[model samples]
Target: MIRPSSLIFAAALGALAGCATTSAPRSGAAVAPYRDSIDLAGRIAINYSRDGKRESLSGKFTWRQSKANTDVSLISPTGQTVAVINVTPSSATLKQSGKEARTAPDLDSLTTQTLGWTLPVSGLRDWLQGYATAVDGKRFVATPANDSVVTRDGWKLDYVSWQDDAAAVPQPKRIDVTRIALGQQVDEMAIRIVIDPVAQ
Candidate 1:
């Protein structure tokens, strides 16, 4: 699992956010919850930080019963592996190099802390429908719990292109994000997630 702390990423092209130092997984074990609130599955693009530069990668998460049961593989632009996390409801495991590391609930905190980022659960769900809510503390166009526009706490994220999707929620791909603190301009970080899936 990624050691949650700070992260340093050199994305395809963008500014970096946080930094972290970690060793590869030792054994292939079960991956536990990074948080108790969610389990997710979908094809996603993760954009993050390395050496203060933004980085991007694509992968899929398979989760069930509050446990992530999936084989996720991430490939760096250079064609090398950053890491692969295999998560299960009860336990977690990772395979790096030739060794595998298996652990329990530790995997959850470890991954997020190691990566120094928050996995995009809200984004992933909304991505399917093309709408998402921001974390309560994070800045955005609005809130979810008490926002006037929507019943949710996150921003009233909407996608209104010249065309619309047959699906009810617009795909996050086309939707633009405006930080509440900021002006009309969309947020670079949020937009980055919209175009590409990444941890917040």
Candidate 2:
């Protein structure tokens, strides 16, 4: 069964574009590390299945991230605030309307325990910016010709579009992420993120 927290967190945090195929490693320039701080407003869509029932959710989101912490707000199509999530290096918190806030020592554990899935916040922070840290500890950068990367933590990321095709290092406009089910208990999940052109 899909939990409400799963749907909420999926919309709050943030990709799948093409066939869930792995990308061959190719020569490319390294992408610069993500900035220390950013305020991004965008939309997110998620699709997953459980108990043989398929479900989907789409919502708007705003992400305010800094080196020390991050804040995310999930909004409904009618502009109502669905949930608020705050994350720090040591802890994470999630609050839904009229309910007690849920807290955990960290995001990975938090989502896994409460939402029944791994949100992979750490890896996602980089994937959202068109880069990834592979299991080997090497960084992979996204380029027009070579835009797909399989992350170290088990997610496949496809850089579907770029902010500026001509820029030396293009920012990701749309990122599609997919994770195949690890076991019968885990469902395959796909999330699509469309970042707005201008940062708020």
Candidate 3:
């Protein structure tokens, strides 16, 4: 069984937003309009080596985030509900198709206790919008000229493609992430995300 915590990427999606700063546009660059809530559907893949064995998972996900709450659903390629996660300011809950729901104080603690690694909870929300906030709290915006950033928070991110190259500020369509681990706490791990375009 995939350990439940391995599937808590949804909690990371709903991580605390109080720490996030709105991205500032670089001179002459445009940014997507800010919305109080965001809804997205996409593909996600995770690969990692543990106990000398390699494991991988790939699936589709739907995410809904608002100021007050966030809900995420992980779906298998065969269209089965793999897991569902709900997160709020105080707690996070994960429920798989046939298992009891698990709760945690936050994603970092949950994943650390279960997976021996940390998710980029501090930076993921910004990353989804093509921006990043490093551990020191500096913001990096993605542009064609500069598409990769080492977040200094244990991961390196690459904005592989954009939704519209001709737009004033292109939004990320695909993102690649790799672990930057110093010790055994994190082994070789990689994640790739491909975001679906918003429906008209």
Question: RMSD to the native, candidate 3?
Answer: 3.4
User: Candidate 3, TM-score vs. the true structure?
Assistant: 0.83
In order, the Cα lDDT scores of the candidates are 0.32, 0.67, 0.69
Model 2 per-residue lDDT tens digits across residues 1-200: 33484444443372111111123333656454556577888888877765677777888888877777778888877788887888876878777777778787777666766657665435666666666766465667787777876666677778899888787777789988777345122454678889998733
The Cα RMSD of model 2 versus the native structure comes to 6.0
Candidate 3: count of backbone clashes, pairs at least 3 residues apart or interchain: 0
Write one digit per residue (lDDT tens) for candidate 3, span 1-200: 55543464444433423234576645554667545588988998877676788877788888787866667788877788777777677876777766777778865665554456665546666677877765455667777777887775767888898888678868889998777766223566677889999887
Taking all chains together, each candidate's TM-score versus the true structure is: 0.37, 0.81, 0.83
The TM-score obtained by model 1 is 0.37
Best by TM-score: 3
Which candidate model has the greater lDDT, 1 or 3?
3
State which candidate has the highest lDDT: 3
Worst 10 residues of 2 by lDDT: 14-23
Off by over 4 Å in 2: 1-33, 181-187
Shift of residue 105 alpha carbon in model 1, Å: 2.4
